[model samples]
Target chain A: MYIHAVSHYFPSEVVGNEHFTRLNGLSSEWITERTGIRERRKAAPDENTNTMALEAVRRLFDQTAIDPSQIDLIVGATYTPYDTIVTLAHVVQHNLGVPDIPVISVSTACSSLINAVEVVEGYFAMNKATLAVVVVSEHNTAYNNETDTVSGHLWGDGAAALLISKERISDEDMTIHTIITGGAATSGKATTGVMLKPLEQGVLMPHGRDVFINACLYMPKVSLQVLEKHNLTIDDVDYLIPHQANLRISLNVINTLKLPETKLLSNIQKLGNTGCAGCAIALSENRALFKKGQNIVLTVFGGGYSFGAMLVEV
Target chain B: MYIHAVSHYFPSEVVGNEHFTRLNGLSSEWITERTGIRERRKAAPDENTNTMALEAVRRLFDQTAIDPSQIDLIVGATYTPYDTIVTLAHVVQHNLGVPDIPVISVSTACSSLINAVEVVEGYFAMNKATLAVVVVSEHNTAYNNETDTVSGHLWGDGAAALLISKERISDEDMTIHTIITGGAATSGKATTGVMLKPLEQGVLMPHGRDVFINACLYMPKVSLQVLEKHNLTIDDVDYLIPHQANLRISLNVINTLKLPETKLLSNIQKLGNTGCAGCAIALSENRALFKKGQNIVLTVFGGGYSFGAMLVEV
Candidate 1:
């Protein structure tokens, strides 16, 4: 499948450690050192999960020139939906004037975007859809504890939309070469311990170290699998877009893989971890850096102990 | 596609109008008159969405002698998932010991079972999976407000599973003939007014009159489209399994279509509306009513203002 276009949206408001210090006793340097994030975008009072997704999808439609009616499927990957009854896909379909097509909502935490991509591949493979749109949006700030220095500074609100088509682009345009994807849980005992907010008393607690350990170990292994599948080493790849869970984890995976600095793409320093939208947002923002036939690897480790990787030739 | 077997699970505990009378000031006669439901089942405190789905899936595996790992795809249709982090399909896969295969969780309200069928059809069309399982489960009791007489007594908790395979048993071994699917919203001023729990006052308040009018008008029309495409008439159908949204709506549709009384299959009087599980559960329970080479029609309408119809030969 070829990615015809990609777009992302981050709200206008920015929250930094100074704002956190006013709410909690944390310094900017301390927060930055712990999570590799200095600031993050926050949704305005009126902005929401649906609004962010619509912004990204609207831009994608404008850029791709694909009519919404031509899109056969709409997949929304998010943990925070505006309404459980209606589904976020319905909101997007209604807003975009494509209400008759089949819509599905997927939630696999941070790896959700790839999961949605896999589903789109299934539709394409089945000849059920010629064109598909995947919208991944998350409001991780809703799950943050303003007083918790670890999570507060490590989260952000944003959305990304990618338009995929079974019609392969010419080699001169762009292409996806191969994908190697799999995930496993750690005995169902190594819990990430992360919880969504509006929790009672001690509900929302996470073992950040355990999560870091899992990401540092599993992601690079998956990335290597994709590289091996394509018979290409990391040295041949031009860019590696890892899920923006944290800046430290990305660097750790890069160093462990022995990849060069110029090969890594990241936006967590400014955008923080946007949950499912992290990798897609990074790719959309850095599209200019990509060249025809350039090899790029995208990997993600998310909640539910899920992780996946894909190799694309751009 | 051939259906090897079908199984369903309804919680053992049944709640009658006597139970509702104590919680709300509703008379048994009034409840039975308003909706065709006389009683409904609620899952035990320990039973959840995953457990209910597992129960139905186990029955399918046991009856078909199919290994969990051999099943290529698992599609779970539900509105009440345990958490937003992991899809209920993953929980089902883990519980069933089929963790490697891809799983998709789809939410199309009460039409989810039919939607899952369409997805499996696509897979078979693409030759991706020789065998697939589609599970529809609902724990509607969790969202019911005892005070809301309109919806509280109309919903039940249950699940159903179908084993669809690419191998053909015979030319008429439960093959999909045609599926006409679409959705339409009422004018901008009109809304379904169906509110999900824990977010919007924890009640299911639907505009009963509008929903009834819409179902009576649209359900038969879609059914006709499916029959017309198959070059058959209503007189040729062996049975009709409409989504168990209400007894009155079903009867109204039957009267308008002028179908024979012996040809309609209904379990709503015994099990109430089980949301996405309604059509599947009804089919599973009433399979004895169908004969080889007989035509059957399944239609559904639900909260997303969505409706679909499919014709099949059993």
Candidate 2:
């Protein structure tokens, strides 16, 4: 499997930390220091998971100018969906007016995009599809509880998409390394405090300590395992694209792995935690900065005790 | 991929048609005649999508006496999940104490299981997973609206599990035909009346007429397309396993395809529509009757305006 292009879309609303700080009786400096999030984008009143995702995919198509008829599959990853009945992928395909294709939605919280990448890789391997698109659209606002400071300020709305194909289309296209592996540890779910429960208001309460600790432990472990399998070390990785859940968690993983701070790539400060789209969006924004041949390690941990890591070359 | 074993489990509560006949103005004979549903299972007070699915997989393991360790991936298909955060796959893996594996939840309405099978097949084709488990556990009782008679009486709660391996383990193992293909048409969502709107009651009000007309058309078309790809026709099919939404819809599809009535295997008379688990549960209950080298076609349509078809061999 190879990545032909990557793109992202965010709503127009740029919400600053002052809103939460004033409402929760905390200073802007405190919020910034705690989460390293100065501002994040919020979906507009009319914007939604489906529309944002559609725009991101349209942007990918615009940049690549790939024929829409050539795309044979659409894999959508989302934890916060606009509607439970009409899938995000179907809405996207219908809106795009693309040909009838296999549109599947896979949910494993924030690790969704990587899992979807592997899924499309399988399709390519089996010759089921030659060209595929993977998109992650999340409306975290639907699950945010305004009064609950822990989770309220942590979520942001956005969408990201990537075009993958079995054949390398151009010299600029990046190939995914053969050392991709992902799995989850269920014991992490037993730590009850960190959970996204469906309340009357659709609020997701998170235990900040438990989530931070578990993410620090698993993200590094999985990243190292994927690297070790390829007979490589953290020093061999040019860039570390960890899930932008929190700057502290990302920093912690870097310190644990003893990687240089410059290698840590993130956009959470401006984007917040976009759930499944976090790391993929970061990659899309940072794609131009990478050389033609550089090793980038993508690691992620999400709600529901899901964690995974994959190494790709750009 | 080859199916090593298949097993299903239903809740203890057997809800007879009389429960709906007395509430509404219809008689038991009218209910059976219209939908061919005499009774359906309802989950107990303590049972959930995860518990029901866990039991189904446990039965598969016990009956086959296969080491649980051999299973490397778990893909759970469901439209009604207990929580959006904790995937049904993660919960099942937690309860079963299965090793750390990729636990993914996919939703394509009632067509979920067949789509999941194709996803796992891709994994096998790429050698990403050796032995994978696909479970369709539906708790339709969670979304049923007693007042909306059209959709309420048409749902039942049950779960089914299948162990699919890249290699055939025994002489009795069933191999999936090499011609498996699946895709969805999105134009159906444009129909106005047939939609599942999110309401305060958490109910999905489906338009009966539109669903009937479309399922009758697309189900047969996709089924024939898949068979034609393999140089086979409906007459060559040994069994036609249509989604157990309603007996009327199934019969309409059979009439359109001109498939023999005897070749149409169904359990909707006893197990209403089980959502994503419908076809899989029917297959599990009827697996013993299947002869070697039998050709089976599974066709399904779900509320999200999604539909697909798969051809398999036994």
Candidate 3:
């Protein structure tokens, strides 16, 4: 499979650390030192997961003209959903005017984008669909608890769209070599570590240490496994776009892999954590920097304690 | 792929239509005439989506002892999720003690089981997983608005588990021939027809007529589409397990397909609409009747306005 185009849309409003500091009594310096998040984008009150996703799809269309009729699959991945009933996939399919294709919305929490892509891979492999759209959108701000001191400032609302094809449609299309995802919920703190109780608490991380430890272990571990499966090594990877969960986690992955910090591509410093959209947004941000024959890997770990890695050859 | 085993679990609480008559003033006779439902299963106050799903999986284990280490994939399909963050997939994975496999939760609303099976198809085609479990679970009662007159009586809490293998494991194994799913959200009444607002008015069918109209049109249409895709005809099908949305919809599909009423395998009269788990639960209910060389088709239409048909040869 190949990526024809990728695009991301972030809400226009920039919420600086001062906002969280004022709301949660956490210092700006403390927030930055802890998470490396200075300011993150927050959706307008009227905007949400679906709107941001639509804009990202519009951007994908603007980037490259795609025949809406030929698109056979649409997969939306998110945990913090706007409307689980209407769903991001249906809304995207409705707005994109794509009819009669399989519109599936999936969530393995923050590792959802990889799972969505894996869903597309299934369709492509079955000859069920040739052109597929994997839309990753997250309205973290919509479920953000501004008063929580632990993870109050760690969320941003954003969406990313990827136009993936069963085969290379153009020379610029990047080939997806391998994608691997697994669950570790059997381990400690998988359920209680990060919770999104829309009715009770918004989004909270009660055991940040457990999450940090598991993410640190699994992200690099899965990255290496995916690399080893393809007989490739970390040295061959040109860029590593880890899930934009925390800058410290990404740094840990870099340190474990023994790569320079420049090899790590991230957007959490400016955009906070956009959930599943995080890695996809970072990929879109770095799309122009990719060169032919360069290898890029997007490795992710989620709140369900799910982890995944996708290898892309640009 | 072939089915290793199929199992279903319904909560002990039987919610008869008289309960709806008491709550929403809809007579029991009226409900049976309108939706072909007399009574439905409701989970106890403590029972939930995950617990029911785990029970169904345990039943699968009880029926057959498969190596837990070989289960490489677990796909959970549900629209009415208890906790979207931890997700049914992760919970089942954690409870099953099946570590390090791909755990994905997918929703295309009530047509989710077919989509979940399709996800497993992808993993199988890619050689990613050989042994997979597609767990269809729904906690619709948790979100059902008992006071809503339209769809108040059309929900039940139940779960079904299907252990599918890439290759047949035994002589009794049923081969999945064709599975086709599509979205119809581009058409009218897609979004607002069947809504599940967790915090607001829970599970409302504001456009029951639109849902009924579309369900009647697409259920048989996709049934024939899947049949034709495999060069089979309606005459080849020994049983039709339509989505248990309503008795009226299933009867319409039988009429459209020119099949006898006896050919229709239904459980809606007793289970109401179990959402995505409905058809699978029905299949499990009638499992013993399936004979060698018999062709069974499970066709479904869901609230997201998604439709699918899966053809299986026993």
Candidate 4:
């Protein structure tokens, strides 16, 4: 499988650190030094996960000039949907006017986007589908409570779309080398303390430090395992696309992996942590600047202690 | 991929048609005649999607004697989850002590179980994993509002687990001939009138008739298409395992496909529509009675208007 096009959409409204500083009674610099997020986009009242996903895919179609009818599979990765009855992928399918084809929603929180890629690779490998589209739309605001000063300031709304095919459509297409061959580990029964329980108003995540510590450890471990599967070393990787959750976690992984500082491609400073869309969004934003034969490694950790890694060749 | 083991778990409490008849002021005979459901299990307030799924997988482990450590992947299919933060698959992974493997939650509403199978087939096709476990746990009661007379009486809670492997575990194992080769079509913009909108109580389905008609039409269409893909006709199909949403819908599909009435194996009379777990539960219950070298067609339609079919050889 290869990626023909990549595009992302952020909501119109841009929020700065001052927004959280006022509510949390902390200085903007203190928040920025702690999280490394400058400004993040928040969705408008009418905009939602489905609509944002649709916008991102529309951009992909516009950039690649690919017919929507040619897309035989649609995979939507989102922990947050407008509702459970109808999935975000279904709404995007309805909006795109794409006929039939399997539209699947795979949720592993932050790892969801990469996991969806693995799911689509199955269809491509089985010859069940030739052209597939994956969209990662996250409304982290839906799960983040305003009063929860810790997690509230970390979430931003965003969506990223990828057009992948069994056959490369253009010379510029990035071929997937090993589509999600690594393993995923969860924190298991220890999930109670660091939790996101459903509340009347969205959900609640009580422990941020526990998530941060586990993420910093697991992200590097999974990425290395994926590299080992292919008999490749860290030196073979030209770029690292760690999940853009926080600058600190990305830096931690970089230090742990002993990769060059310039090898890390990130947009977390501008986008905040977009949940499942983090790595995909960062990849899309930096794909154009990457060389044709560069090797990129994507590592992600999600809430509920889910973590995974996938190595891709550009 | 071959099916090594399949097991299902339903809640302890059994609610008969009399329970609904008394509440709705309708006769038990009328309820049974309208829908082939006589009794359905309702999960205890304590039993959730994750716990039910865990129980089902535990049964599969005991029945097949397969080591949990040998399992390479876990794909959970569910529309109703305990919460969005941690998926049912993640919880099951924790309970089972399954090692570091990819645990994915794929939701296509009621079509989720079959679609998850399709996703697993891809992994098996790519040799990403050898032994994969699929658990379909639906808490239909979570979204059912008791006051909603039209849709309320239709839902039942249940969970089913399937162990699919690239290699056959035993001579009695059912081999997959054509694993989800057909296209899945959604009803598109026609979904507004019939939807499960998020509400304070849970979710609400405003239109059931539209869903009934669509399921009846698409169920047979996708099934026959899959059969056609394998260059086989309905005559080759020894059993028809359609989603157990309603007996009338299943009957309509069997009649339209011109399949033998005796070939239609269903448990809707005892277990109300189990959502994603419906067909899997039915298949597990009837697999022992099936003969070797027999062919079975599984067709499913889900909310979000998603539907698909897969053909398998016993």
Candidate number with greatest TM-score: 3
Order of quality (TM-score): 3, 4, 2, 1
Q: Candidates' TM-scores? A: 0.89, 0.93, 0.98, 0.94
Q: Which run of 10 residues does model 2 chain B get worst, by summed lDDT?
A: B191-200
Each candidate: chain B TM-score: 0.94, 0.94, 0.98, 0.94
Q: What order do you get sorting by lDDT, best first?
A: 3, 4, 2, 1
- lDDT scores in order: 0.75, 0.80, 0.90, 0.81
**Tens-digit per-residue lDDT, B93-117, candidate 2:** 6766665577788977778888888
Every model: Cα RMSD to truth: 3.4, 2.4, 1.4, 2.4
User: What does candidate 4's lDDT look like per residue over A1-314, in tens digits?
Assistant: 79899999999899888888788876778778888898888999888787899899889898887888788888999887765657778877777777677788888878787788888888888887899889999877766776666667878999999999999899888877664522334463335423444434544556666767777888888888888888899999998898888898899899999998899988888888898898888888887788877889988887765777778788
lDDT of 3 by residue, A1-314 (tens): 99999999999999999998778888899998989899999999888888888899989988886777778999999887777767889988988888899899998999999989998998988888999989999999888888888888899999999999998899999999999999889987998899876556678899999999999999899889888888999999899999998899999999999889989998999999999999999999999999999999999999877999999999
Q: DockQ of all candidates, in order?
A: 0.34, 0.50, 0.71, 0.49
Shift in Å, residue A303, candidate 4: 2.5
The 10-residue segment of model 3 chain A with minimum total lDDT is: A195-204
How far off is residue A141 in model 2, in Å?
1.1
lDDT of 4 by residue, B174-258 (tens): 8876655222334633455235543345445566677778888788888888888889998999999999988998999999999
* Candidate number with greatest lDDT: 3
Off by more than 4 A, model 1: A18-30, A143-153, A168-174, A177-218, A224-233, B123-128, B168-173, B177-180, B183-193, B228-232
| Preferred candidate (TM-score higher): 1 or 2 | 2
